[model samples]
Target chain A: EDQVTQSPEALRLQEGESSSLNCSYTVSGLRGLFWYRQDPGKGPEFLFTLYSAGEEKEKERLKATLTKKESFLHITAPKPEDSATYLCAVQAPKDSNYQLIWGAGTKLIIKP
Target chain B: SAVISQKPSRDICQRGTSLTIQCQVDSQVTMMFWYRQQPGQSLTLIATANQGSEATYESGFVIDKFPISRPNLTFSTLTVSNMSPEDSSIYLCSVKVQLSTDTQYFGPGTRLTVL
Candidate 1:
């Protein structure tokens, strides 16, 4: 069975504080790992996609890195505006299915 | 990235009534998907809407309960039939863009409350 697990269900940090959220997975084959930021009562916004091990992508103050078994979303100098639920998902290439296995998500609270 | 929109941002409906949510994409996409998010929970895919074929429902979901329609590459609809209080959730429409390695773009979502 393919499963995704995210650690630290919730976190609170002051403005400018930096931290990393972890997403571990168990799958048949890893095709892609996706990162998304979702605000309360709103849909998730796409952030980054890491395709292979050691791959890394960044947007603004957010960075995402992937390995064979897990991925990490690192927030740098986070602001209150960055406070939201961060989700991680994995897509299996061999499955040829449109479905994505998702993690429960890490709720991040950035206090200014 | 594709721009997606969903209708009826939030609605409170009586139990046993049905609600149809519409999803429109700015650009044509290969696949459109529907998802359900219970309060404070992660997303769970409901079905995959294909352009010319019947929607493919995920396990634990059925077409009879949640009928879906994909009229074209850019539009789709999901109807929640026989609604119940447990059906109260945030329903999202997503599209898989051709470029960027099949990444999905989601709409603002329809918040449904069944009472």
Candidate 2:
């Protein structure tokens, strides 16, 4: 089974604090890694997609990096508006279809 | 990026009643997906809606209870049949901009609260 595990279930940081959220996965064949930001009672918003190891993508204050077995979402100088649950998902290879396996996600609370 | 919108942003329904959520995409998409998320939980894909064919459901989800309809490439609807308190969740619609990649854009979501 394809599985994804995110570390630090919940995080509390002050404004301008820098932190990183981790997502590790195990799958038969990895196709891609995705990052999303979700607010309370709202749907997830797409952030970035990392394909291969050593690949990185950035958006504003958020940067996503992928490795062979894991991925990281780094937030630099976060603000209260950036407080949201960060989700990481992995797309696994199938015979002819692909399904995404999601992690529980890390809840980030940025206190201003 | 695609702009997706869902109707009835939030609703309170009684048990045994069913609710149908509609998803509209600004641009035509090849693949449209439906997902459910319980409070404080990760998103679970329910099915994939194809324009001309039947919707493909995932494990633990059936068409009878969660019937889906995709009339066209830019529109779809998911109906939660025989609703219960356990069915209270946020239903989301997503679409893949590129078929080869797994990058999916999501709608604002409909928050259903069964009482």
- Candidate closest to the true structure, highest TM-score: 2
The digit string of per-residue lDDT tens for model 1 on A35-103 reads 999999899999998889999999999999988999999999999999999999998744455348899
Q: Candidate 2 chain B, which ten residues in sequence have the lowest lDDT sum?
A: B96-105
Chain A accuracy as TM-score for every candidate? 0.94, 0.97
> Which digits, one per residue and each the tens of the lDDT, describe model 2 over residues A1-112?
7899998999999999999999999999988899999988788999998989999999999999999999999999999999999999999976698889999999999999
- Tens-place lDDT per residue, model 1, B1-115, is 8888999899999999999999999998988889999998999999988899999888899998999999988999999999999999999999889845768899999999999
- Full-model lDDT for every candidate: 0.92, 0.94
Instruction: Give residue A74's error in model 1 in angstroms.
Output: 1.0
Best by lDDT: 2
Q: Where does model 1 exceed 4 Å of error?
A: A93-98
Docking level for model 1? high
Q: In model 2, which runs have C-alpha deviations exceeding 4 angstroms? A: none
TM-score of each: 0.96, 0.97
